[model samples]
Target: MMRLSVATLSGLPGDIDRPRYDRAGIGTGVVHLGIGAFHRAHQAVFFEHALNAGDLRWGVTGASLRSPAVHEALAPQDGLYSVVTRDGAAERVQVVGAVRDVLVAPRDPAALVARLAARDTHIVTLTVTEKGYASSAADSAAGYLAAALAERRSTGVDPFTAISCDNLSDNGGRLKQAVLAAARQSDPALADWIEHQVAFPSSMVDRIVPATDEDDIARLAGRIGVEDRAMVKTEPFRQWVIEDRFSGPRPDLAAAGVQLTADVAPWEEAKLRLLNGSHSAIAYLGGLAGIDFVHEVIALPAARAFVAALMDETAATLTPPPGLDVPAYRAALLARFANPALQHRTRQIAMDGSQKLPQRLLAPIIARLDRGLAAPALTLAVAAWMAWTGGRNDLGAAHAVEDPLASVVADALGKATAPEDRVAALLSLSQIFPVRLAGDQSFRQALIDDLALLQEQGARAAFARFTGR
Candidate 1:
């Protein structure tokens, strides 16, 4: 079988939307870090639209910071991959050619640095997730960015905009902080130059991109009549809201249906607290209930009600900016979650609870607690995560707890039998929970009670009680 590449693209079925632009003429202008499935299905789709609209400079050179898997998959195909969007039984496949190259930063950081230093590369985007920030400034994205910015500054080339497509709150500001911190470690002058010259624009990206396994590959092969190892599966609903702050020329993303806004905070808060918080809750509880996909999780009466109630509690802490409809967004999220074709796995979303909890669940939880309001639904999700980290489901099957702090979480749970004792011990870890929030007697008691309930009755019963159904 022919693989999906530039040569084979022309033979693809007409219904499968291959790139309309001339791939041979497209030049790399955007350097993306973390060439994960989410990047391929979401941002790369928009860049393809940019290319199709005849902006040849929007081609991407994606860098996989830790894994060579993406490079190995896409490089042989000329960075060509399919974005398959699922809505019910219907699927739309588009071959995105905007990504011209994939670089493994670990194998050759110098190559990635060279691409970053290139004068035509006016924008750099990241979807490296929350845990990627943990490495020291030298090896992390911050370090690489600092090195690239220094080269650009020395060579008298213009600085590029650094956009963070990660879900963390104020990620743009946070990236700037990390980059400057790394830069200052070597040369204060370089840090100063970055502070003034570079623009770290925050962005809010929303799309449920399921990790493509062998099954998805086979399914896509059956649909497109080709082998695309780098293909990604996603939901039809996608969004990207970027702060309208850039150092120089940028891809006409707005032309491709992006929201280039002045203040990305409101949009960020809405998605993080409502959609993401609900996702975390469902992933943990559904995983415990032995539900495979997100739609199946939402199908359970108890789980559906719990998700609605949880979103309501989280939404209470938000002050959405004008023109943003909170109710509509919440309703849409439930419908999106119930898209049966998406097959978004609960175990997949359940990964990295420690890294994701702060912005997704904890901040809203903290907001409600500080306002003298009970965060019952919010605390229930945290309790689910604690239960998930225990490594065994109600079905008596063991699953890996894939978190950067798995050891620390294990040590925190060490030899503790009682739910209260376990809850108090885990809460004391100030890395995930705030110092004051950890010590708060009311918050501590709530988590203790929720954990006790999960232990006593199991996930479904606990969710029903949490939602008062």
Candidate 2:
């Protein structure tokens, strides 16, 4: 019956796991973009642990770029929320007080710029997904970041680290490129200063944080005896591998189970290719099969073997990170994907197929082609995406496909329904497929065969054909 807030922290039940430090005493040192479920479950929880260990300066000021929804949800609660980590029947509930305030960018862009320029704000992190990095400086997160950094420069304040927790290869470099490119449009001088001064550190973050629904909120409220509309339910496993590069002081994140390294490429590539690649395969193929959840897909014998083969093909293309056991790491990932309590939906991952395929699936396919090897599993995954993108599932049910390139996909489908024609039409999309892959006869033939098989045999049978099981 009670609402969660800093004032109510002390009045909660004695058994409730609430903030150890005084919420009012903590200062905001990090400004995080995209106040979504993933950030709440992963990064904010880590900051809560650091705060619990007596670090008061690492509190986060959450910012949302598009709407006022997150700001509206958390402001009344003083940025208080519950994070429940679920692994099968076991669960741990904790109230996180790491976020002190929430800022909606459109409502007050100047406030966000001021927060970024603040002297105490040493880290500006983002989980805005890949599409947030717009190519132009006119309307993007990079544009806003550029404007804020320009303000800091004009005021003679130092630059902070720009950490990207997005799942992209060489994401730090990409962030730097986006930021510098945007800054160049306004002031070449400011761009130069940011390039020379600020640190754009790439990071690899892994956590299965599902989109919370009314059921999740009600379940948390029932357990904690307080209403927490901003609750996040996630899997127990978490990993954060960050490049050890920063312009200003940062919290000892290593104490919170973060891996600080000189090079984050291997880790980033591994997670992208191994975890993300197979995830896409499961999403597209499983959705085509009318499977609702990732755990259900991974539980299938054919699906499990298909994912393993996909990972094996991708692994051949990667150089493992130092001290990492590739085999053991992969086995652990399979176990994590099979966690039914996480309830990671296939439809959730199936969205944004056009934007995601380039990095997650296509890159590994390109690598295999370069090595003069046939990546049938990867090709089948690509075919599955093409079929799914046609705007209907195997059950003939029409679901909303939420890709930025929805028009492009529709155009591709309109051109032809024949296997070869459809495969050619989709492959010619230079945005998603590389020029070399598009031109390769063998790759094109392989994709056409797989696509035809998917159409004729259905998703499960096509998957069994690829796995030869």
Candidate 3:
């Protein structure tokens, strides 16, 4: 079977959409990091729209910080890949040509730095997940930006706009700090210049791109009559919200259905609290109840209602962006979660609880407290997470808590056998909890009560009480 490339595109089904622009005339103006499935399905597709709109300078070159698999697969096919948008009943297949090249940073760090330093590369985007920014090694995203920005500074070149498309509060601000720290490790003067020149824009990217396995590969091959190694599967619904800040010229992404806003803070808060907070609820509670996938969790009446109630609790804390219908957004999130075709694993979202919970749950909990309200559902979600870290399900099957702080969590858990003691021990971890909140009697008691209910009655009973089932 012919691999998906510029050459095999001519033989695709007439209904299938291929790039309308000439690939040969396109230049790489955007350098992307963490070229995972999310980047391919979301930002790369948006850039394809920019290219199709006749702006040939926005073609992308994706660089992987560590993984060579993406580079190996895409580079062999002229950096071409396919994105299939599933809407439950049917699929929309399209070949994305926005990515003109691929690079592996570890293979040749100089190559990636050179690409970032290129004159026409006015933009740099990333989908390296939340934990990617926390890595301090020189091979990480922050390290690469520090290196490239230093080179650009030395050579009298303008710095590129660095956009973080990860889900976190003040995502841009966090990335800027990380890059600055990395730069200061070697050159403080260079870090100072980068602080004033570069623009680290926060962006909220919404799309469900599941990890494509061989089954997906074969299914897409049957549809497109080609064997593409880098095919990404996503839902028809896609959204990108970017902060309106840039060091140089950027593509007309607003025309590509992107929301370029002056303040991404409100939008980020809404997503983190509502959508992501509910997701964590489903993952911990559902994963503990012996559920495997997200749709399966939503299919359970108790689980579904619990998730909705959790979102409702968090929604009370957000001041959403204008024109965003809160009720409708919550409904859409539930609908998206219930899509069975996507095969989104609950365990996948359950990873990095220590890293994720502060943004997703704790923020809203604090907000609700300030409003003189209780976060019953959100507090229970945290309890479910504590139970999940015990590494076994209600069915007595082994469950893995895939977190960087797993051993620390275990040590905390091991410090006590009683529910209240366990709650107190975990709360004392300065990494996940703030000093004020961790020491508060009301908050600690709430966690103790919730944890007692879950550990004693199991997942169903606790969920039943939350849902009034």
Candidate 4:
């Protein structure tokens, strides 16, 4: 069995697709943080298209902030990997060669900083998730950016655009805040320079890249007759929308199906509230009912109806971008969620609910309240999350709940055994909930009633009642 690398690419079966561009001629102009499955399936794939179109300056160098696992996987292969887009039994396989190198931040922080400082590296992108942003203490991503910008500043190098592909609203603004805060801690002068010169452009990325498992690897290997440990599996659908503002040169990504817009806020809000909001609902409620995969949950009558209702309520709170069809978008999302081949896990999406809920569910809920409307479906989704954070499901089975605020959730659950008291305790955490909504009696009672129903009956019954299915 030959290892999948540039050296082995020629020996690969001619039936498989390889990079169309000259891999040797490509330069590493982009440094991406958190080169996980999602990045490989989304951003890396986009750059591969750009490279194939003769844009040699956009080759990416991926850097890992915490785990060396991704570096270990790709470095051995010379930064080559395959992406399999599955649509039912159909699979489209392409070997992506856009990633020129990968580095572990802990092993060689100076090298990482030097890469960011390099004149060739004009764009810095990140896929670090919502919790990756630092609200209090500095995070690794911010710290690295601060150091890199300091070096670039001292050396008189031009600043690069910082693009955040996270699901958070106004992600660019949020990331800028984190980087500036981190830079300010070391040198306020450097922070001031960064604030004026650098550009943090918010972007929205959509793709269903599930966590690759042994089965996916084996299937891919069977198709290509090679062992590539860094293979990523995703759905056929993909979308990227970036803000047009940039501090320095950037690739013509518009030719690569990327929507370059002056305003990404509308797209971000719709995606966060509708697609992400329903995803959280499926995770908490569906996982509580012992459902494993997203498709399985969406297949259920009650779950499907609940999600549809939830999206409808969320859409009411949003103003769709011009020329966008809200109903079609909703339909497409449901179909995407029901992608049987993807096997997106409920538990995987359920992680980091404490950080995720404020944007995905809470924002829309607050919007409805501001308009003096009751959001029962969104309220039920929150109640399901409360039950999920209780550490046991409706089946009386215990599962480990992974969240940044897991300890706080545990403490909240421990503080009260009653449904009303539990809802009160969780809502009292002003960080997660807005004061107006949390203080609303009707909203609180909606959560309390649903929580009681979920406790007495199972998730299915409660969902059925909530949706009147």
Candidate 5:
């Protein structure tokens, strides 16, 4: 058992027997906002592999706005961590050394502003999740962008690019609005500068990086023969699509399986609607049925059929983006969701239901309804969400609901005359559902009916009825 610095452990995987590349030479070029399991397993791993294969100047500097755990764990070891990739056959272990530093969000607003103003910091990326943005535009309010813009206006330092790795539609544009709005509040001149200098690039990031469990840590230690404070496990598949908007020198990530293009809207829409939407369906429905793991739900016959049907409906409405094959892409997504080794828990995916429902479920429902197609399955999923949010599941386990309006939601559910009214009240929150969707009578009733069914028949029977199988 050797005690190695995080930096040293990062270089160990490649240096086990034969050296891959000059691990010590990699430099940090990107700053990531959320240092969560997904980023560690997906983006960090990509950068690590690229660095080992002779690419440099693309190391990641992980940061967080609230969590001190990431900073505390990685800072002691020099911003390095281990990633374990698991599938059915074999587990590939790697140490990622590409993270050069980790920063906590500025406790002092001025200092946080100054950090972003740094000239050498080329790309500012975020995995702060959907809710982290505090977005309000059919999404969160983009609070981070507002803060950054306010800081930039006062400081006169320019950021190169604002990359959003969250699962949102037009994430870059959404973030830009928040930043520009914040800038406009203080100084119009700063808003102009941001409009001209800052590049808010949209991206589609995918990976099923589950939270680290004890067995995962033990396996990492056993395989690598070292102590890794920060270890993340994920499924084998990973994809990153970015709009090529950079204010400074950027990495040639295109050489490492990343797609760079002028427009990432179509790709973003496809991923959000297909993969993420399917995930939301499984998470809410499965969690309500007392299923704990995502793979376990997908393994069930009825749940798998429901998911496949949803994907089929989604695929019908969406054409694949350029350079993508729809059928193959979907087949792969289904396979990824079914990976038993990953054991992605339903509750983990179920978090942030209020923020996630719009993008992952409601948006697709709107799209389908616009085309005059039935989105009954999606509606049922929404019903399950309302049930789950009411703070009780089939097992009587209290759901650790995390929405900002949790108390309001709980109180509303308590006083509502029936399931339909509960659905209506939740939708009317405006903070969760948009005014347009909230006003749709047909949509509201569909949700009510499905929720009533869920309460009466239970999740399994309700799902069986919806699928008619």
Candidate 6:
């Protein structure tokens, strides 16, 4: 075994074509809050490409709020890593050098805060997932942003742009509200400062970065002939849409094919409602059918029809974003999800249902219902969720569901005393659904009916009934 530096590991023959750039000579200009796989495969790769071309003031400092394993692994190598993109026939490995440091939140909050408040740190980006936003119990991003903004105010620092890569509508505005609330909690003056100084940029990020397994590690090592600790693998396709809202200096991401626009609302809505919504549909419905992987679900006739139908329903409610070809976009999404090489797991997608359901299922359901249309596919997905979380699958596999509201959901399901009561208790959850949605008698009944079908029949059979196949 050869001792390898991060730079050496990244420059192998089959990997990134060049040696890692001398990043120590440049200043750290970006602090990425969540150093997850998607961020590494998508944003970090983009930043690395930009830096390779010319821009040096856009290096990233990886920060994790909870996980210390990443920090420990990358720190030994001076924050250098590799990204491997895989489709069915080809694999490309690139050494990403943009991250200059890795910071664990609790280990050194003071240091993290100092870096955030630093004058040279022009951008603070997050891929902290929807749950990390510390949004209220009622599904809002305002709470987390408020806390971060309060830290900024108490420290009296120059403002940097906060970019959210989470899949949400008006992600930037939601973050701003949270920051302001936190500032207001600290002092009225702090909130006033935030209103004047801060900028929150909404973004839509798309990439199917699956969890790495032993086979992936071996494949990467054999290809590159080096042990790259930070290697991540994902589906070949990727997309990022961002609002051009920045108060300070930022990278020229446009050079790397990133779309920068005045408003990201339309793009966000399209991606969230179509791509993410369909993903949830497949995950829940597929998981309950005993399918283990996303590709497997896509291969199933019922699962495929469910996703396609859901997308069709979603498309009816959404107008294409400016300059986007709706049919072409939908075609690409279908192709991406059906890529067998990705092997994204159902259990992985199935996590955080409480945080995901409202945006991915309920919103579209409500929108369709408002239009006097029935969203049967969406309703079935919701029913699958309730059934999936009700503790046992058809295989009798026990589910240790994860969510802040898991206990409550479990308790409510337990009291199922009856199907109607179960649906009522679940829907009436103000934390997961708006009052208007909870109070909808028709919607409640639909949920009750679908849930009953899911309980009586299996997932595949229930899906068939919902789709009338």
lDDT of each: 0.90, 0.88, 0.89, 0.89, 0.75, 0.77
Model 5 Cα lDDT, one tens digit per residue, 31-114: 777777788888777677677777676777677767678878777766666777789866876666777767666444344444
| Model 2 C-alpha lDDT versus the unseen true structure | 0.88
Per-residue lDDT of 105 in model 2: 85
Q: Could you give candidate 4's per-residue lDDT for residues 158-274 as a string of tens digits?
A: 999999999999999999999999998889999999999999999999988889999988888887888999999899889999999999998888889999998999999999999
After superposition, the stretches of candidate 3 with alpha carbons farther than 4 Å from their true spots are: none
Q: Which lDDT tens digits does candidate 2 get at residues 334-378?
A: 999999888889999988888788888999889988989989899
TM-score (C-alpha) between model 1 and the true structure: 0.98
lDDT for residue 221 in candidate 6, whole number 0-100 = 74
Worst 10 residues of 1 by lDDT: 131-140
Residues 1-469 of candidate 1: C-alpha lDDT, one tens digit per residue: 7788888888888789888888889999999999899999988888888899988999999998888999999988988998888899888888889999899988898998999999999999999889876654566999999999999999999999999999899999999999998899999999999998899999999999887889999989988889999999988888999999999998788889899899999999999989989999999999988888999999887888999889889889998977789999999999999998888999999999999999999999888878888888889899989999899888889999999999999998898869998898788888899986897898889888888888878898887874554
Residue-level error in angstroms, candidate 4, position 102: 1.2
Better of 2 and 4 by lDDT: 4
Across 319-384, the per-residue lDDT of candidate 3 in tens digits comes to 889978999999999999988888888888999999899999998898888888888889999989
The runs of at least 3 residues in candidate 5 whose Cα sits more than 4 Å from the true structure, single-residue gaps closed, are: 1-24, 106-114, 135-158, 466-469
Better of 2 and 5 by TM-score: 2
Candidate 2 regions with alpha-carbon error over 4 angstroms: 466-469
